[model samples]
Target: MATELEECFHYFGYGNHLSNIHLHNKNALKVGIGKLVGYELHFGDFPASSSAKNCWKGGLASIQEKPGSVVWGVIWKMNQTDLEKLDRQVMGYRAKDVTVEKVDGGLISCRVYQLSEYIPAAPSTKYKRLMVDGAVENSLPNDYISKLVAIEDNGQTGAVDATLVDSEETKKTVTNGDGVHTSKAIHQSEGYFLYFAYGSNINSKRFSVSCPTSQKVAVGCLKEFCLEFAIKEQTSGEKFVGATIESRLNASTWGVVWRVDLTELPKLDRQEHIKEKFYEPVDVSVDLENGESVICRTYRVLQPYSPFPPSVLYKSVIVIGAEEHALPAAYIETLRSLPEGPEHTVGPMKSYYLEATKN
Candidate 1:
């Protein structure tokens, strides 16, 4: 009598998981070695839980495409049920398939896990040790092992690198796709987006009125940029300094990081008047106070105008947020000292948008 066979899944374990100990836990069948082309490795966004700090430090290991780059890892075969169980262990990561070249010179396709977005961050000493040990255990390459050792220095310096291959010597981070220092608009999955608010929107009460689903995540800092109130109301001439990212290496801007549900994105977009007229949505990758960086959607105006101080209500909203987030005390005082307004005009204008949502 003939017997039926169970369907199996194929994958390439590139990170610490390459250790046979982890594979045994997952009950995955270890195949042979495989080499992936046109991709490189980097430490991505922070790990799923802060409690796992000793494991990932700041970011988890991930792969991104880079011309003339390659990564070597163990190939494996696993049953469907086991694959599902393994997915739960790797939260905040998605598996994508790529064609790899086997050690025997055969090309085959396999799945690899990666973060939703690529962020430049350093990995923990423990995480790097696992990878280094796994690489030697699997005999990846002498140069590759050296590259893994250098990563320990990075975590100590708190500097991010473009790739883990060690040849590029990438000193600075490239936040946007165009490889230029300009405004960018980050797009996330349907459930949520990381929205960056540097103006009145930084205030939780005010921001919630426009986006009820918003949840404050962290206090963010953007490098090479400073706050400005260049845009003003055409009719009343009331000024409210929205966020404008100007190029000044020594300058920095503080803002709030909020997770806005995708369901409320449309309403918030319209409220911001993002019709390419005033305060258009932009994408930026900002570093948080906790030594992690993230991609967020922000706003900036297209036209440039002379600077003016923000109004009383406007400055008050910003100060309130700055204090609530416990941003540096000096920064909070700076916001309080900004020239405030004609309550006669600013009060009514603030009412138009600053009203709190009804409970």
Candidate 2:
């Protein structure tokens, strides 16, 4: 008598589970790229009750039904024994039966697991890499793969409690599509805008004093602009100084990009003394370290005077901010090597701002 063969079922994988090397290691066989309709991929954590809750940091990929949405992933052919291996490997996900469309337009009933208790969050960089690698291996669409690459991750290696993540109210962060987060706002009729600061405002502490909503996102380079201490200020019965950017060939001004709420525009304008006409906000494209360029609002001295060295305290602030953002070493060295202007008597307002920036 012939023995009965075990039945096999299809499995849809949208995240790291698409990795054939990993899937095969777990005794599962890969089919090919498949599509699921009415579902979208999101990052979230495992439920508290699951032993695997501690596996993923920040967030992991999971599917949720959204009308008119599509999720692309790999399909796997696995039997009941392989299914047990998959369940053990994916700790917090509960298996759900769904219909997926293969490349040939054939519909197959598949098993996909989603986090049992979904909490919106970001994934870790390593976790994201696995998903991207698997997507590439399975020949997913480039546009769909780009979306996977755009998912932000928590800057961690292991799963962490959501409470431990910084609250959005405290510091708003926006992704630059390269896994970097920044915060700060510039003047817009209404809505958040990116602000590029290459001067003393590069200092987060100083920028926060004026634009409290500002959060440093990514370090960006303003090409064809030279950083100069040419913004002359008259106070304390003497010549004071600030930094500015001037158009120059083959020049690059490195600074921080901040995403800020529109409500902080007035505060930023006042800090930059827009009414005084000391500096003018200009729209410029800034190239980020991640090989992407963004248009940002930055300030240029309205009438830049001859080069003047900044005060020791002021120069220190710029240098500190540069170092904090890990700007080019040569640039930081140049800033440190520059001569300091004559010291001006510190005033009450200057003292207040200096103190505010210390925090």
Candidate 3:
């Protein structure tokens, strides 16, 4: 798009806009990674008049002029229409013309957005995840990625709120030609229940394999519950461990909460082997990062086995899922500290789980 011709403009994305997924969804063409000199990234408060405050309930990212500072971001080549769409999406930001330094030591003129007036604030976990994942996706400097990861959130989980939702959010259910509902958020509003996942299901890709109709709502913490790899499964006459949680004094288990519709309950139940009585759904109160608690349905082992280590592939899925969702680094380390089992499980999804960690 932004070739030698003048029909396109280079746009530098430093925040959640850095996500290629987001850019692609907006129909913007990603060019490459670049750096902006003398400008530093800042987490600024959403203006009171901006609708983003109601939707996000957290800080917003912006760039501020600062000497001797550099901000790394992805450069997207967008036409005039795409630029207009971007402007509408970023409500309070204003575009400014600037020059970006590409990796090949080439300078490119670009459009960068910034807030006219900045008020410092913390970002939400969801927003931080977007930026970190984008940085990793574009292979930005590891130190810069670490800096983005290290920034703290304001404790609001960026879960969709019914009353304060975006005006553009789908309000009606629309069925496609295949008879499948096109919008998952509409189901979330009408016939969905909260499901908490503390194991491998926390990874979006892994979770999608089993529960295609479900949508992640937020990250939650189940207090007084401790995670253990004690659910043993026999495959080819060998035992492999699976994850389960148990009540423990003063312990907390971090996990993801999903919004699942009643129609897909059968599918989820089948995956958990509900008919086989391997796991039973139990109701528990999961505390969200927004300081609110919600009742959620989660699975527990029906027959507890002796403590066993999980297979390397199994452990990799859980750890990768935890990291993929940008869960607390300390909790991820705890997952990483787990020892691998003697043998890997042979299952339909085994290859899928193993392939996920390579990225």
Which pairs of residues clash in candidate 1, taking residues 3 or more apart in a chain or in different chains? 184-282, 184-283, 185-282, 185-283, 229-241
* lDDT of every predicted structure (CA atoms): 0.64, 0.70, 0.71
lDDT of 1 by residue, 45-131 (tens): 653452222224455778889999988888888776667666655656778888989988998778788776545677654456557
Model 2: per-residue Cα lDDT over 277-298, one tens digit each:
4555655678898899887877
Compute the lDDT of residue 237 as modeled in candidate 2: 42
Determine which window of 10 residues in candidate 2 has minimal summed lDDT: 175-184
Worst 10 residues of 1 by lDDT: 165-174
If both were scored by TM-score, which would come out higher, candidate 1 or candidate 3? 3
If scored against the real structure, what TM-score would every candidate get?
0.45, 0.45, 0.52
- Which tens-of-lDDT digit does each residue in 1-359 have in candidate 3? 56445677788989877773332234578889999999999988766665443345567889989999999999988777566666766667888999999999999999888976656889876567557757765778878877887898876542324344232323342322111112222235477767899988898888887778878788899876789877455434454456787654457899999988767765776777555545655556788989998878777664535777878888888888888778889999999998888555434457667666676
Question: How well does model 3 score by local distance difference test?
Answer: 0.71
lDDT of 2: 0.70
lDDT of model 3 at position 235: 33
Query: 354 in model 2: Cα distance from truth in Å?
Result: 3.2
Candidate 2's clash total is: 13
Which structure among the candidates has the greatest TM-score?
A: 3
RMSD of every prediction: 16.8, 17.7, 14.8
